[model samples]
Target: MNATTDLLRVDAVKKSYGPIQVLHGVSMSVARGEVFAIIGPNGAGKTTMFKVMTGEVASNGGTIHFDGRDVTRMPAYERVRQGFGRTFQVARVFRDFTVLDNVIVAVEARRRHTGEAVGSWRNCAPSADIRDEAMSLLADVKLDALADGAARFLSHGDKKRLEFVIALAGRPSILMLDEPTAGMSPSDRSDIAKLVSRTRKERGITVVMTEHDMDVVFGLADRIMVMNYGEVVSTGTVDEVRNDPKVREVYLGKEMVSA
Candidate 1:
């Protein structure tokens, strides 16, 4: 892909925790407006890889380029400003705050980051425009009705959806979801998958996700990257990865080919 189309490029990223190493020179590229998935069994360094890319933790080596700028050393919040929005494996939200407040906080943060004058949360309530924008984002995830409810009281599935809305408030160019459907029922999982698909298509947002559910992975990914023992084993389209013998032996079973 050309420079304009290649939105994210990770060149030989490596990470280590003292004596132990987690990532061994991992490299990948994500084109704009595509769903790229990284899949593997437990302890495959998938989450670590996400952490590195998102700047939650520093990479020991290599570089990360986004939107044609080098962002390898950028802080997590700065990366967010640079258009990287992410959700963790567990839903992270303001549990004590009302659902509406949760998204309002995100919207205000985005505005503040962009040099807009936002009233401090302690000094004043969110402005009408801010409230409207937050509500609009909540409505997108069907969380508008629960706007006044305490976030802690929401169900796990609802919390996941809320977190998604909060992420959307950041106005991301690329969203990295770490297990977007982790603890949901099959139906709830389907809901999140559909939400992701619909949102990506509507907004033309690029998505990079790591998920264990084969159905979700195959359903969403335009290209799949298989990781094993901290390194990539395969990278290709759905059919190519599914048919790869190495991926089958290390991750997918032979039965998956027929399915």
Candidate 2:
């Protein structure tokens, strides 16, 4: 792929927690509109790497660039302004808020970040336009029916869908998902996977994700990056990474990948 087509670039990113190093010279590039997956063992530093990429945590060293600009030191909010949308491993919706309100908040935040004069936010009710837009997002995730329902009352799969809707409200250029299908039944996992694939296709957004389910990973990812012990073991097309000797030794075994 052409270098210019790359939307996200991580170069030698390093992170540490106290004396324990978590990410060691990690580097990868995500092309625009590609579904990229990062996989490894439990302590492989995938989440830590995500934190550094999204500005949730500061890196001890190295640089991160997005859309042709350096964002290594950018704060989380500012990164959101630059079109980074993220959903956590655990769905982090506003439990007390209604499903509609949860998305309303996200749309409002996006407006604020972009300096779109949305009127006084103090005691402000969601405008008709925002409500329509928010509902549209929810509908995309098939959660519009639950618009007035409390988020806390939704099933775990529905909550994850709500979170995805919230992220979509930001109109992100790239979407990052951490274990999007975690802690769900196989059916729910399949639902989330389909939602992700459909959303990416419809929006033309780049996706960076980590998933433990190899079936979901192989089914959705255009490319895969394998990590081990805070380092990148391999990065390539799914077939290439799946066949990599190093990746086989450290992460996926022959049986695992073949199955």
Candidate 3:
């Protein structure tokens, strides 16, 4: 695809903490509306990579381009304003805030033209339009019934859904999710996978996620990027990656036993 169609591009990105290097010259790209998955074993730097992409953690080397702008040095809030949104592996919600209010906060954050002025607790006049949009998102995530309930009261599955709504409030061109299915029940995991699939098909939002659940990755991702240690060992479709001997050796801890 052309530059105009690329939503995110990471070129030769590297990161190190003191004497230990975590990401080793990684490079990848996400198209405008594709669901991409990054799968690897534990401590493979997947979350670190997400943090670097969102500017939460600075990369020691390489470039990150979002919507054709160089954002390697941009701060996290600035990146959020630039249509790069992310959800953490751990559910982060305002425990006391109403479900709707939590999403409204994100909406306000996105509405501000100047990222510096946006505050997590800032109160903005809830315009009819904003309310409608926020409510719509809540409904989309099946949280409309609990819109007025305290965020902490929601179940774990619902909390994950709320995070998705919060991320979407930014109208992001790229949505990065860190283990969206972690700590979820089997049915809840399936629900989330279906929600992600529907979101991708209906909203055309580019999805990039790091997940350990191979079932979730295989079910939702259009493409998979497999990393071993600090380096990407394979990038391909789900079946291709599953069939790659090197990927199996690193991720599954054994060579693929042929039928």
Clashing pairs counted in every model: 0, 0, 0
Q: Where does model 1 exceed 4 Å of error?
A: 117-123
Instruction: Give the clashing pairs for model 1.
Output: none
- Higher-TM-score candidate among 2 and 3? 2
Which candidate wins on lDDT?
Answer: 1
Query: What digit string (tens of lDDT, one per residue) describes model 1 on residues 1-259?
Result: 3568899999999999999899999999999999999999999999999999999999999999999989999999999999999998899999999999999999999998898867666767788889999999989888899999999999999999999889889999999999999999999999999999999999999999999999999999999999998999999999999999999999999887679
Please identify model 3 stretches exceeding 4 Å from their true place: 114-125, 253-259
lDDT, each prediction: 0.94, 0.93, 0.87
For model 3, residues 106-199, the per-residue Cα lDDT tens digits are 8877777644334345555676677788999999877999999999999988998999999999888788999999999999999999998998
Candidate 2 whole-model C-alpha lDDT, 0 to 1: 0.93
Sliding window of 10 residues with minimal summed lDDT for model 1: 116-125
What lDDT tens digits, residue by residue, belong to model 2 across residues 168-219? 8999999999999999999999999998999899999999999999999999
lDDT, residue 221, candidate 1: 96
**Candidate 2: pairs in clash:** none
Off by over 4 Å in 2: 1-3, 117-123
lDDT of 1: 0.94
